[model samples]
Target: MNDDLHLRIILISPPADVDFGLQSGSGNKYKTVQKQVSGNGDLLFVLSVKIKNDKDGNIDFAGPFVQGSKGERFIYIDIGTYAGNPESEWGRRLKIPLRDIPVSVIEKLQPDNKLILETRVPGMGKDGGPNCATVKPFEGWHAVPV
Candidate 1:
């Protein structure tokens, strides 16, 4: 839980799995590459963390995101979808975009040593699936600078 990690938050377009087809059902086996991040659909913002040896550690899941005037703008994860399944690393990791994020919210966050999207024990990801992310933004995720 070191709080000095650097993360990069980027607004990304949820790419379609050219290999699995955009509508691939319960299973998304194809891996994604940076050059392949194109196409359209819901926006997904991801926290790109630098892990050991400078390898990029990806923090997916449409959990807590760019906060808004009303509250923290969190995204929803379709249960059992490609997002919920971490295997879809190359594509849709279920993250929310930052364009919709406000400047005020971004100012309140700090980075951590590593990437670990936090999940509460009594919450969805912990007990059941990432059920609608019903509990809203998973609480303990540290991100990189905006």
Candidate 2:
């Protein structure tokens, strides 16, 4: 395994919007959803990264590995922190700061090897109002030819 293989984990933050839902009455009355906003909140996201083995021979990919029912394959990653916004709105869109993630591989893979990555962000709520939304990376992983 090389030093680059050790750098295979990355954390990134994307853009997000505030979602507002209105409660309507039968007599043309409506209610607005009230929620508390703060600037000291953090956004977290999880990523799943998989390195596929296609070519012949032995290859060691440097990254976290989770055991599965089928076999000892690679998939999904657990990233602790990322980037997010701190704007408050009833229902609006806002651009927030994002985090940077970098991944390195120590070992080399065979030919036709593929890598897949997925990102997931948990939802948060405040003051019994709607949960805060978060934006994450579109794709989690990348593939490299060894």
Candidate 3:
């Protein structure tokens, strides 16, 4: 992977059943325009995510949160979501808002050049499937080249 390429992932929560009434297509499609990052070489990959609640409920969009190393490791920008109910298993799902996640390779990795990005619902099973036994604050992991 080229160090100059930037990777970004953003999660968006659509209105309940409203679908924004846009084109009917993939469930994980993004409606926003592609964004570019300057002074970084070039934008290589961009991923837009749509997180939906299995049950009828509301998800809040808080903003963007940063995860992983500050300079060396890849950065995860969370769009933010409303806090789910602590008592209800189905209601505890975190909602990520719609936006562009910006990723840039500012430095070089120590040993490896390839990075892997992974995401999962915290306290859930290997698959992201919903289950009452699972807990909230789903966990997501992202690995990127330095």
The per-candidate count of clashes, in order, stands at 6, 17, 9
lDDT of each candidate versus the true structure: 0.29, 0.28, 0.26
**Model 1 over residues 41-75: C-alpha lDDT tens digits?**
32232333211111243222121222222233333
Regions more than 4 Å wrong, model 2: 1-98, 105-114, 133-146
Q: Residue 71: error of model 2 in Å?
A: 38
Question: Residue 63 of model 3: what lDDT?
Answer: 12
lDDT (C-alpha) at residue 82 in model 1: 40
Which residue pairs come into collision in candidate 1? 5-112, 5-113, 7-144, 32-90, 45-96, 45-97
- Model 3 agreement with the true structure over 1-146: per-residue lDDT tens digits: 22222233323221221111111122244222232211212222254222222233322112123112222222232111112122322331222222222233223322356553433322222343221222234343344642
Per-residue lDDT for 118 in model 1? 28
For candidate 1, the TM-score is 0.23
- Tell me the RMSD of model 1 versus the true structure: 14.3
TM-score per candidate: 0.23, 0.21, 0.21
For every candidate in turn, the CA RMSD to the true structure comes to 14.3, 15.7, 16.3
